[model samples]
Target: MTTAGTPTFDDRAVVLDGTLVVADLHVGRGTGGSLELPVGSNTELVERFTSLVDRHDPERVVVAGDLLHSFQTVPRPVDDTVAGFERACREAGARLVVVPGNHDTMLDAVWDGPTEAAARIGDTVVCHGHEEPPEQGDRYVIGHDHPTIEIEGQRRPCYLVGADQYRGSEVLMVPSFNALNAGVVVNEMRAGDFQSPLVTDTDELEPIVWDEQGRETLSFPPLGEFRRML
Candidate 1:
């Protein structure tokens, strides 16, 4: 069994106890500007999600936030993608919960399942991190920033973990689950650069990258010190 209050990082998702957590899916993202073209295929998302669910067999799957991309309307492909996620969870017998983010203005049109502004599991509260969470907990899991790190000119998606970050609570931030998002490079970012209120000190947060080839999670020094090395 997984330890309590600790997260198991994999790709863009985190497994906390029996819950599988992902954020910033941003479905229907590629249809906009020339620069916003899709980077990854939708089928790859379902395959990755199913692989995670099958491997972990979690009791619940929580989307931390930003399940959709367009702020105005829900497109047909977006709706289909949402259904694909739901079907995957249902088949695995895991309950799915969506914590709406700032971009999920039209989430209700596509998703009718359970949603929470802040969903709590054990001592951890999961939120989209676009705004202040309604409730408090010992630890907060959020996804608004979609943090990444650049090393040797190669950018990789990463997770940020900090202790006593907000209201004396530890904070865990995940990258965007959607592969299409290149993510915000945090090598030179400070706390003020982030949109999430949960992040107050960028220096205290450590960046963690999952090495898929090595089958290991590499934890780097806190951003405060790591920035100096880079």
Candidate 2:
């Protein structure tokens, strides 16, 4: 979480046990392909990471997944985004480790960092959550749903946490790093409505809301109970 140094919330990037974890950079789908006139998402993304690197000074940065957006072809701008990302990490003095997401069928076409099926820092297992995560870990950190919540007509990115239904490990789902990708509003969604296994597999989702200052604002009740009150 970084405020003045980075955009509010760092868009849900979390630092735990020294290694910094961020997810769903989605670098070149026009930088927010769905937005009307997206520009410099590439620059903003790099700058956000740069600020994180400067603030945390972590030795390692794990891209939880989806560094690229286009699946069918390597969009020309995506290559530049990757290069700029590499440059940002290099300048910040942290090593970048990419864990492939479903969209990154050709992630290697651009990024050449330490790629892995998953990266473990202590008991925390970092995965993209497209498929099943690794079998042996006490906790899982993932992205992909791009969790969001709305209050007073304004949407804010959020983090979801709950105990795994089957595996028993704690799971933390980060919001998308892409600002324009306003994800599923957690308060209005059913647990099973989500695409991630860790999400759909359990109804224990608890929403952690952060303000524009990257400060924790509210921790909503678990979805199972919250749904009834809603």
Candidate 3:
């Protein structure tokens, strides 16, 4: 259970209540499975998570959504990568939990640890953001949009945050953990551009970008405010 404090944002990880939460890993993304060109290998993902775990030393690791890719055709290599990911998580000394995403419809066939449609972490609701989150949680943390922001003419993955008018809750949108997926730039997004319906209405969402080394953080105003500047 998390105490009374806001979640801490870092490179590809949201520290919440001793849990290192990440989203949109899209394992097996290389080999023409996820991107136009190959970028990372399974070992790279393992190493990255290993570093994150070693650095944060969280009690548990929660993959908010999209742990794997290739839903229509689950390649054998992808399956192996998923298996390896689960093993890597355990080796890092953090229990792995997964939430279902649209691309993860076939995830159960690969690995099974702890799975749920949504999870309650204190006042925050952790979900995939493919659908409306439950009302019980005062705040919602989700990852389906794969948010990013442009800074100094360069685009980087970012966390989108703000109060949700429709849901009447605080909303935090996590960036895709996979380095290859650059994610949807919040400024360029249009209505229905995101899988989560809440994103379309939340024009006031603030953009928080973390440096590659996770040593610095920068924040931008809401999209509405940003658009007016342009």
- The best candidate by lDDT is 1
Give residue 38's lDDT in candidate 3 (0 to 100): 51
Instruction: Name the lDDT value of residue 123 in candidate 2.
Output: 62
Please give the TM-score that candidate 1 achieves against the real structure: 0.94
All candidates: TM-score? 0.94, 0.86, 0.88
lDDT of each: 0.88, 0.75, 0.76
Q: Rank the candidates by lDDT, best first.
A: 1, 3, 2
Each model's RMSD to truth, in Å? 2.4, 4.9, 2.6
What's the C-alpha lDDT at position 31 in model 3? 48
> Which is superior by lDDT, 1 or 3?
1
Model 1: runs farther than 4 Å from truth?
1-3, 31-40
What residue pairs are clashing in model 2?
none
Candidate 3 lDDT score at position 13? 78
- The digit string of per-residue lDDT tens for model 2 on 72-124 reads 66766677667866776788777889999998887878876699899887667
| TM-score, model 2 to reference | 0.86
